[model samples]
Target: MSVRGFVPGVLATAAATACAYAVAALVPALNPTSVAVLLGALVTNVGLNRPFLRLGTQLAARHFLRVAVVLLGLQLSVPQLLHLGGLGLAVVVVTVGLTFTGTRLLGRWFGVPPARSLLIATGFSICGASAVAAMEPVADGDEQDTSTAIALVTLCGSLAIVALPLLRQPLGLDAASFGSWVGASVHDIGQTVATADRVPGALTAAVVVKLTRVILLAPMVAGVALVRRHRSPDTARARIRPPVPLFVAGFLLAVAIASLNAVSPATLSVAKDVQGTLLVAALFALGTGIHLPTLLRTGGRSLALALTSWVLIAGVAYAGVRLAGL
Candidate 1:
């Protein structure tokens, strides 16, 4: 429980994420940065760790990816938030609140195990794998639960990648507004761009709103962790502090990098590409590594929760988008 000896996992997470980045850079087909990262990370989860690397893999993934996300913020433009201003802030508050509450309440009602329920909720509400990683420790999500959360996020997020952009094309919405809609509704930042590109100006708005939402992680995690601690204070002698999750910090860093334009668009794009690959592999790992017996034992509950969460999320996301006139 001390987790003092878990250093190896940390190392592995970095190595895996890095390996993903390298692969993305090398692959010409993958232009978007998140795609590569998603693919590479997924590959690492399935191929690299299988039969040999599993020992510290999850630890590495859980711990190191946060730092990577911090490093990722090489792209954020703070001034943009000012440009979008009130609308951006509103989007963040509304989307996050809806997703978190819907998933939590619905999942609980459906009887999903607590960890799986939280994983589904957070992934749906925030930036997929990264958000799940950030929430994992606070919720005490074990390996399987973490994988499940990441898997669902990746699967759903990937679909959004292809669907959102195309979906917006027919809406007759302008670019900026489309971007905001995508960012507000879609799971990943990359997906937001793809979805918004079908329109004008929306891409930028989406990113701005998404980044602003990202900034709220500090408060959200801390508050959730605090509430969790109070709810289960008996067994836990000490409270779990869900400070700003490191990957979220890294994700912010990635945003900064993009914002400053310090890192070339090519480089940022490549990093995102790797992120995509990583996501694919993570999904595979999630599927393959599942403990069938355990899932069978708890799956009925999880399914119920997942369905309820989805209903709540869909209802809220739709309402919020409509309320914003998107």
Candidate 2:
């Protein structure tokens, strides 16, 4: 918390994020947030850690990511919300709930620890690393588990960037259906945009559906916090905080303002840019905390959960699209 401790972590995060942006510029297909995470991991694994940067990196990963997620709400508006309507919203709710439940059960079957598995389930089923970061305190999970869940989400999301496009043609999906599938299934907004942008008519549907899933993030986090509190012993009950997180409140406010169309287009664009930048920096901070050896110890089980979840979501999304007649 001291200046000396904080400055180093900020500098490390900033540097890693800078490198991630550069990489993204060169390889536009790669998600900048995921690239930042990988770069952060690379820096740490390669022994580039400075002692002073530790606390700052932790702050960046925890606090900064929440801020970014709030900014993310600016990208949504009433029009996009209406596009999905009742059916689209229902599909998002169903898919997210099923994926979350399935992943947790699968994680148990794989013998992964409860907290870590919960984090993984939230991360994979919801908004990827941001969701994982948000759920960390609520779940009272280990940093190692947070990093591992993020890494697995990143890995699977990255794979989808490549694999989804290939399957697009083979699966004979039209533009709208393909977009809906990607929006429903992909972990992060950046990854969703990148995947659906490949096909015409897909981008709009993808963004709409993806943001619908994002809208559910608040309740999901609140539900987790509530569960954790109820499950805690009566002696410790007094220590439990409110179920709704502050940043999630900010997220809802942003969405409400955005829906009102109060913000100018130029201002919204700037917020979007800021959101992306903050997320990259946060992911880099998170990456620096990772230990490859520790991650690998549970990697197989985590990977299995991720792969199974990926398949499940993809299939579910496809079914949703077909059922909706999109």
Candidate 3:
């Protein structure tokens, strides 16, 4: 039986999601990514407070997030990623590579226990909030590590929302390029939107590229799960096999649906909206999975490594985008 009972996060996710939609309708100027992340975590936390509730809410939450991720993809096309062409592909490679490099080196440097570094690294570098959600079950990350990663991504993305506008002004870049850079760099979809809003005329490109990165996250998480297994000594004796992360599969299937020519734009848009709502809820559930004291047990080294990974991603985003002329 799950001991932790969810209350606050669920309350937070529902209220926040409502707030996101209301502002979108009334003020017509709000972006919902980070808020969704927060609310998702909150709502799911409450769902998990009881076994029956957790089971139902958890499944529903995942289904929603997956659809959201796919719907978000409808904003892009194969050609755009191809347009950035080889250089565009490089952006993803570098972002992912740097993230992994930082995680491994820092993890070792800080003595960050074992699995924590890998999980946080994937979350921060590849897809942000979604990546962490996908990686948790596969990597078997303890509840606390997952929570810490969520908190870190959310905090960083929030800071970007405020800082990105000023950044665009100083950079002296045009819309498409800026969008590409932001898409290539930011941690989550909301940050991409928030960053786009601040930059002027950057939404379409940024959101699309960000979706490109999001689609790539599943493979990275799956790989991490395998590596973790290879390194585990007990695999030989205990015959443990890693569990396939269901959300990752769902995320892929959603992508397939989005890629189909048969799906109408209106239908895709609806799917995205609904999924965005649910993904946020799933995150709420993942947040519910978090236990405060358990997170604190991370070997002191892990925190330092995680911090370094985040710092590197943020810094690289700015410089890499500029260098790429995005």
Say which candidate scores most in TM-score.
Answer: 2
Q: Cα RMSD to native, each candidate?
A: 5.7, 1.6, 4.8
User: What TM-score, over all chains together, does every model reach?
Assistant: 0.70, 0.95, 0.77
Candidate 1: tens digits of C-alpha lDDT, residues 212-324: 66656555766777777778776543343435455555566656666677777787777766655454334333433455465567666665555455445445554566567
Which of the two candidates, 2 or 3, achieves a greater lDDT against the reference?
Answer: 2
**Candidate 2 C-alpha lDDT tens digits along 1-326:** 35776887888788788889899889988888889888889888988877667888988988889999899878766577678888887788889999999989998998888888998889888889878877887776788888888888888898898999899888888998899889999999899998898887899888889988887888898887877677774746426566677888788899889999899999998999989899989888888878888778767788788889889888888888788876
Residue 290, model 1: lDDT of: 52
Error of 3 at 190 (Å): 1.7
Q: Report how far residue 175 has shifted in candidate 3, in Å.
A: 3.1
What's each prediction's clash count? 75, 1, 18
Query: Which segments of candidate 1 are over 4 A away from where they belong?
Result: 1-51, 72-80, 169-172, 198-201, 233-315
Stretches of candidate 3 off by over 4 Å are: 1-33, 36-77, 229-244, 289-307
Highest lDDT among the candidates is held by which one? 2
The 0-to-1 C-alpha lDDT of every candidate, in the order given, reads 0.60, 0.85, 0.64
- TM-score of model 3 vs. true structure: 0.77
